[model samples]
Target: MKVTLKLPKPRNPLVAPARARKAGAHASYNPARKVRRTEKHKLNQALSGRKTEGSYDA
Candidate 1:
């Protein structure tokens, strides 16, 4: 009779979500200076009930 051993799978880093994978905020060309940073602006937009496009401020 022969016995078999089971091996456990190794844990890997969790893949970041699509939103989280996005780049951080940055300064863009805004004469009105409405959106200074992309990330911060996005958050502010969400709070203000504005549509967020998740685009860089470049």
Candidate 2:
């Protein structure tokens, strides 16, 4: 007598998670969106003489 072994089906890696599979789901961070400060804000910072650099200032 011969016996056959059963194996589980493999999941598809290309498939997105259930939460992401839903419609109208958007990521918190979108690269196309402008995130950096505007030129006006930069000018204000320069005028204020505030150092935006890291711990090197301390």
Candidate 3:
């Protein structure tokens, strides 16, 4: 019996960085959609309850 192995195609690395930059630019332009102090505090508090670490880092 003979067996053949197949390799996956390589990804286009350039596409990813370009897409990330575009997303970052769009997020920067839309200031209102950004998270506010109250929302952030609530999110942190909710996460603290579930996570033993108590806070999200970086």
- Candidates 1 and 2: which is better by lDDT? 1
- TM-score order of candidates, best first? 3, 1, 2
- Candidate 1 pairs with clashing backbones: 25-39
RMSD of 1: 12.5
Candidate RMSDs in order: 12.5, 9.5, 10.8
lDDT of each: 0.64, 0.58, 0.65
**Model 3 C-alpha RMSD to native:** 10.8
lDDT of 3: 0.65
Which candidate should be chosen as best, given TM-score against the real structure? 3
Ten consecutive residues with minimal summed lDDT in candidate 1? 49-58
**Candidate 2: C-alpha lDDT:** 0.58
| Clashes found in each candidate (C-alpha, N, C closer than 3 A) | 1, 0, 0
In model 1, the Cα lDDT at residue 27 comes to: 65
Q: How do all the candidates rank in terms of lDDT, highest first?
A: 3, 1, 2
For model 3, how does the per-residue alpha-carbon lDDT over 3-47 read when each residue is reduced to its tens digit? 988989999989988887735354465555555765576677777
- Residue 51's lDDT within candidate 2 is 41
lDDT of 2 at 14: 73
